[model samples]
Target: MPADPEPTAAAAANAAESDGAFASPTPELWQALGWAPDDNQRAQFLALQQQLREWNGRLNLTRLVEEADFWIAQVVDSLWPLLPLLRERPEAPLRCIDVGTGGGFPGLAVAIALPNARLTLVDSVGRKTQAVQAMAEALGLAERVELRCERVELTGRQKRCRGQFDLALARAVAAAPVVAEYLVPLLASGGEALLYRGQWSDDDQAELDRALALLKARVSRREQRELPAGRGLRTALTLQPVAPCPAQYPRAVGVPAKLPLGA
Candidate 1:
């Protein structure tokens, strides 16, 4: 079980001066997730959060402008979704690729949490990839991560990325239908695609439905929870790719957003 939050004034001030007491969840944020790091791990995580904040200003890597919030929202929040998978497969090392990994939400956090896991952060933009690469290196996580500056769709279509990863992750990167096309080809058979989403509504469900049909995916799970302190609703949709994706997928970049397959 997780312990209570650290009640130091600095902790509170860090949380308060930002947008919320929990703007970004730190080690304190882990309590809400039902887990807590040991003192050593907590300190390491705090230092990493601070480093990310310092670099964020110069590189514009993220909009999580507050230091404390960086610990909570970006790091802890991203870590929450991975716990279930980790618990289920404790012995197996997870091999994951984050598609369109801008500022490394979920990807870097995952790397930090699961040191044993292998992560590949992929993006089409060179500058963004450079930022991720630099941050990972600064955090001393360079050896465990692979930084690839390439278009995910093109990469997926190629013979190489096919069935490469055990898991594929995307956070608010694209619509569910579109993301399915981009993810299916990259996932190994039976690999899972997890999407970090904001708010669950009929429209979102509709979009997911389209993607599931087109890609022959099955909804493995949907973890719904309110963001910390009533910020808003957030959902993590996990889909299992049961079959190979069609060749016409990903629809050239703007195509998916403009005219979604099931739209």
Candidate 2:
């Protein structure tokens, strides 16, 4: 990917102003997640917000640009699901993959917070991947982050990628069943797939159960929490593969989302 241009004076000033505007959320997020970002990590989060703002105009990366919305909806929402893992193995050299990592949300946030995690962020759009790569480099996380510009279905099937990650994550990617199909095949033994959703229902659980049966996975944990300031309800579902996912999993590049496993 090409390098991003050096920030002009106005851009630098804008970023600094943006940083100040969003600065107050750091403590709020720390309290909400029960996890604190060190000085460097906090800086990285600010940089991420700046990058999102800079790129959104050209790439339409995300809609959550306001300070509170970005902090609560993107940063907090991404990291909230990983609290248990963060607490259990804060320094582990975790191998993680973020499927459909548009604008590199939880993936970038995860990399910053964990410090030791190696993240493979996959997205089908070349422009989005390139933007994320630039953002990762700007944050000094490029060394530990890998960007793949391809469909996640293909990534899950590749020998080097399949069954290789300690954690697989998909947020608002698709229906529960489709997200399960996209994530479960990429996990190593004992690895977990964390699905981030909003307003999950009993019908959603039923569909996910049927999908897991086909994927040879089981829900190991489920947690629902209200986003701070009443943004909305969020659900995090962790699925563990009970057996090797059949080689046929993930269907095809567009099939999982179109047909949706167990539909």
Which pairs in model 1 have colliding backbones? 24-69, 24-72, 24-73, 25-71, 25-72, 25-73, 26-72
- Tens digits of per-residue lDDT for model 1 on 1-263? 12223345555455455445454445446666666555655665666677667777777777774744575567656766777754565336778889888887778877766757889888888878887888788777899898888877777866767777888998878777877777877888778988888766777777778767887777788776644543445678788976776777766867776777677
Using TM-score as the measure, the top candidate is 2
lDDT of 2 by residue, 189-247 (tens): 99999999887667888999999999999999888776565456688899999999999
In candidate 1, stretches whose alpha carbon ends up further than 4 angstroms from where it belongs are 1-27, 38-44
C-alpha TM-score for every candidate: 0.84, 0.89
Looking at model 2, the pairs that clash are none
How far out, in Å, is residue 90 in model 1?
A: 4.8
Which number leads on lDDT?
2
Lowest lDDT sum, 10 consecutive residues, model 2, at 1-10
The superposed Cα distance between candidate 1 and the true structure at residue 219, in angstroms, equals 1.3
After best superposition, candidate 2 residue 75: deviation in angstroms? 0.5
